[model samples]
Target: MQILIVDDNNPVLEHIQSLLIERGFESVTASNGLDGLEKAQQSHYQLIIIDHLMPIMNGFQLAKNLRQNPNTAQTPILFMSTQDIGVIKNTAEAALVNALITKPIDENEFISHVYRLLDQNTQHQSL
Candidate 1:
């Protein structure tokens, strides 16, 4: 599956990319939300993993833009943030995020969410 990872932190971006690559998943990355949106428009992604806080644009704004674009409207989005999940839960849901993953990423949980989202995408495509 092809995944897009958007984060300002270089190490975190590389870590997630490496993890996905090691597991045989292809990933593309962007330094911030605006860059991410441009990349998203340029290509196709089965899922998107984005950080909540960024310089160019925030994850919530990015998700809102994605929802407005027909090509990305139904694509699953996963947000990674250091912020409290409960604090942003309602906003994330309102923005149409499929899941909100807390950072300092748990390998098992992260991979599980990735696989689950991909499986869901696959099922929808088959239908």
Candidate 2:
């Protein structure tokens, strides 16, 4: 599966990409929200892991834009941010983003969530 990791920090992007790659996922990355949006428009991906605070667009804006795009409305988005839960909830509600992950991520938990999501999606598609 293809996964996109969008974050302003180079380290964060590299870490996530490497982890996903090791899991056999084809990874794509963008340093800013605008780049992420452009990449998203350019191709289809199975999942998107986006950081909340970014230059130009920000994760909330990116999520809202992606949801508005007819081609990506059904795509799964996982928000990774340091934003407070209340803010996360408000932004998520506006963007229809169902998943929110806090920052300083735990490696094992991140992988577990990613696998769980894909497994669930597969099960849902089968039925």
Candidate 3:
């Protein structure tokens, strides 16, 4: 499955991409939210992984825009942040995000969330 990963941190982006590759999933990366938005619009991704704090646009704004587009309205969005889970949860819900992961990422948890979201997306598409 194809995934779109949006983050300003190069190492983080590379790490996530590597993990996904190890799992046999293909991914596209964007350095910031605006770039991410453009890329997201130009193609279809089974899942979108976004960083909460970014230049040009933030994850919440990106998610909002994505939700307004019919092409991406139902796409699952996974947000990554270093902020408090309670705060992020409130904003994530408002933005229609499917899940949130705290930074200093736990590889196991990250992959688990990825798998669960992808599986749910697959089932949703089938339905």
lDDT values for all models = 0.91, 0.83, 0.93
Q: What digit string (tens of lDDT, one per residue) describes model 1 on residues 1-127? A: 8999999999999999999999999999999999999999999999999898999799988999998999998899988989898888866354579888899999899999999999998899899
Clashing residue pairs for model 2 = none
Q: Write the residue-wise lDDT of candidate 3 on 1-127 in tens digits.
A: 8999999999999999999999999999999999999999999999999998999999898999999999999999989998887876765354579988899799999999999999999999999
Off by over 4 Å in 3: 92-95
For residues 23-76, could you state the per-residue lDDT of candidate 2 as single tens digits? Answer: 889989999999999999999887888898999999989988889998777777
Candidate 1 stretches greater than 4 Å from native: 92-95
What are the RMSDs of all candidates, in order?
1.2, 1.9, 1.1
Model 3 clash pairs? none
CA error at residue 119 for candidate 3, angstroms: 0.6
| lDDT agreement of model 2 with the native | 0.83
